[model samples]
Target: MTFTAARVIGALMMAGLGWFVSDLVRPLMPESTIFGWFNHVNLGLGFLIGWAMLGPKAGGGLMISLANGLTAAFALATVGLFTQAINEMLRLSTRKMYPNPLRALEDIFRILADYGSVLLHPTVIGPLIIGSVVIAIIVEIANSLWR
Candidate 1:
């Protein structure tokens, strides 16, 4: 789906804000911070922007997730981004009863996180979580607005 200028503008604005927040707070956070809250926030924002402007039916959220993941240094971010896309696709496929599918998908991510310490860069893991949340929130909001 073609992203309208509004979507791109909103997504970029949110992503920038997310990065700024993450950069500011990451230094004070513990090494073991659970889920990159900031990153997720940013990602959610991005998703919202894309989904709202491009239309949820256009698969914009999934595309945004992938783009954010690719930009990160952590393997966790990469995995989460791709997994989120898969999850989005699944939800898209089964339009009705998405609550269950969403839960299952998240559970899978948490399970994958168990093995993350071994492969993902320590620095990138937190941001990845943050990224996912950020994207999800944004996309959902935008999608709702559109609808």
Candidate 2:
């Protein structure tokens, strides 16, 4: 389905705000606390924010919201992965001689592989799926009632 301008803007805002908030709070919180469900919460917040801004005007009902939320989650994860890769690269560079392009690429891939495992962990995936489903149901009901 197509995303309206308002829905797109809302989703971007949600993702940006979520990332900003998560980054701000991540350092203050324990790693154990932020490891699994942080992305899920950010995604849920994205969907809620988008829905709140666009309401019935966004169209496509629950499915759209679910799709958008998942998209936002993936986006967040990708950004996190890249950020991790960059940080790792910089840290390594500081210790070693300058890395060639190939070495840098390899380092990024390695970091991505490591982060991928974390992303796919049951604790992370389970909560994200459950949360998205619950949010979708609630959005469906709200949209139905509003119409």
Candidate 3:
């Protein structure tokens, strides 16, 4: 398959897998469980697997793998940010705090800021960095082998 086609399929498969895994684990785990962090790493893994599937002939190397991992991480973060924004907006609206779109947008920014602060904490950053590196290495190896 073409590289673009592979990437599309990989993204869809990864999204489905991520949704499935999140659903399966959510009910079984406590709110404080480390497994909560897995959602962020899922996107990186998906990118790695997708890129690796394209084989060495695709001309991607370590740099590309790292870039893809970063993209995945950012994508996951964006999704989380939007989800948080929607939930926060609903809660605020019910509390009569969001009477206008401007207020709602303000709440979204606040929510994003809160998440940004939390992301700086070691517990979150550590896993994200490690997971991205591991994903890059694995994808690099796979690409080399396929060459």
Candidate 4:
């Protein structure tokens, strides 16, 4: 893939976003042993999303950049949450919690729905929107400076 200042900055910003999101969700998680790689997964996913989505739109106007930034943020949140849900579903399935594969799959959605509501809280969404705006501004500036 092509390397650019925008990509580097975007990736770093989103990586931080992932870390922050993980921290926000920590208190919400039920008291249980968390998977060792949970935070790492979110970091890596956020980096990739930023590189692919936010980075490419860096040179755009403020509104366009904000639009893309918001889209990227939404994608990061949705995909990260979905990954966590799948992990939970797999954990349950391994313990023989589900009667069949279809049931296990359905649990993924149920888990997502449960966490989805929590994500809607003002505390969570406010930071997310603010972060996206900051990222968009910084990335746009980087694009102008570099190219």
Candidate 5:
């Protein structure tokens, strides 16, 4: 497939995968799991799914980042889009600061986006993170099993 086709397909696939995982998770925990440390799974896996499927040869990172941002749009027309935008922006900016300041900022944004829920809700910021990861891992295991 061409670069454009691959990118679109990847983004769509990841969006479906993300939605599926998030929906599966919606019932497992209370509505409070918003801290977001583990929320990166959506962003990470979504990006990887897109990169692996639709990304072009050279400018792969940019395509993945853009696809990730688009996934946010597909996710829903809500506050999360803004957060995802910021996350993608921070991630792009910090590409050079791996393992340092850049990464730290990216992590903070990811956490905030996941749990920026309410002003003072005692959020399970941790559960969402942990739960999401566990669930994503299960999905991955299932994918492997099927493959």
Candidate 6:
């Protein structure tokens, strides 16, 4: 809510990261129908986490800010993963893929595990690690320059 320059920069940077990461993972997705709103969801989540989490820690200190940036990036990924898994679970339930509600609930975790394994690929993690560092440095620079 402070709406500082660092916040704006952080939000936009993370949003870009979101879009890029989504694109990277797109081909790995099992179903095409679920991708319609995927990018948008990631964008919003990234922006929110950046603005609220990373932005506030920008001026705190170099090490602290860097740690926070990495944490925020992981948070974004975790939330996005959960969001997509739940969406997929709901879709599957609607299709009656599970014989019972309990089985449907179990499938959510199964889907999460499956996607979690995919996320472990170097292709997905490498950029995220690199981007977090870059984003942290950029936001810290914006904070110092503006304030």
lDDT of 1 by residue, 1-147 (tens): 556443554466445644554554455545775443546754565555433532333234656644543343233344344554455445444665446656756655564454344324545455544654454445445555664
Predictions ranked by lDDT, top down?
A: 6, 4, 2, 3, 1, 5
Provide the lowest-lDDT 10-residue window in model 2.
50-59
Candidate 2 residue lDDT tens string, 53-131: 4334434676776775565456555665676566666666778845576787678788677666665665555554444
RMSD list, candidates in order = 14.3, 7.1, 6.6, 1.3, 13.3, 1.5
Lowest-sum lDDT 10-residue window in model 3: 50-59
| lDDT tens readout by residue for model 4, 1-147 | 899999999998988888787777777767785756887898898898878888887877888888887898799889988998999899889999999999999999999998787777777767876887788788888999997
TM-score of each: 0.29, 0.52, 0.55, 0.94, 0.29, 0.92
- Residue pairs whose backbone atoms clash in candidate 2: none
- Judging by lDDT, tell me the better candidate of 2 and 3: 2
What's the lDDT for residue 73 in model 6?
72
Judge candidate 3 against the unseen true structure and give its global Cα lDDT, from 0 to 1.
0.53
The 10-residue segment of model 5 with minimum total lDDT is 118-127
Give the best candidate by lDDT: 6
Q: Candidate 2 has what TM-score?
A: 0.52
**Model 4 segments beyond 4 Å from truth?**
33-35
- Please give the distance, in angstroms, between residue 53's alpha carbon in candidate 3 and its true position after superposition: 13
List ranges where model 5 is wrong by over 4 Å: 34-48, 52-147
Q: Choose 2 or 5, whichever is better by TM-score.
A: 2
Off by over 4 Å in 1: 4-10, 13-119
Error of 6 at 4 (Å): 0.8
Which of the predicted structures, 1 or 4, would earn the higher lDDT when compared with the native?
Answer: 4
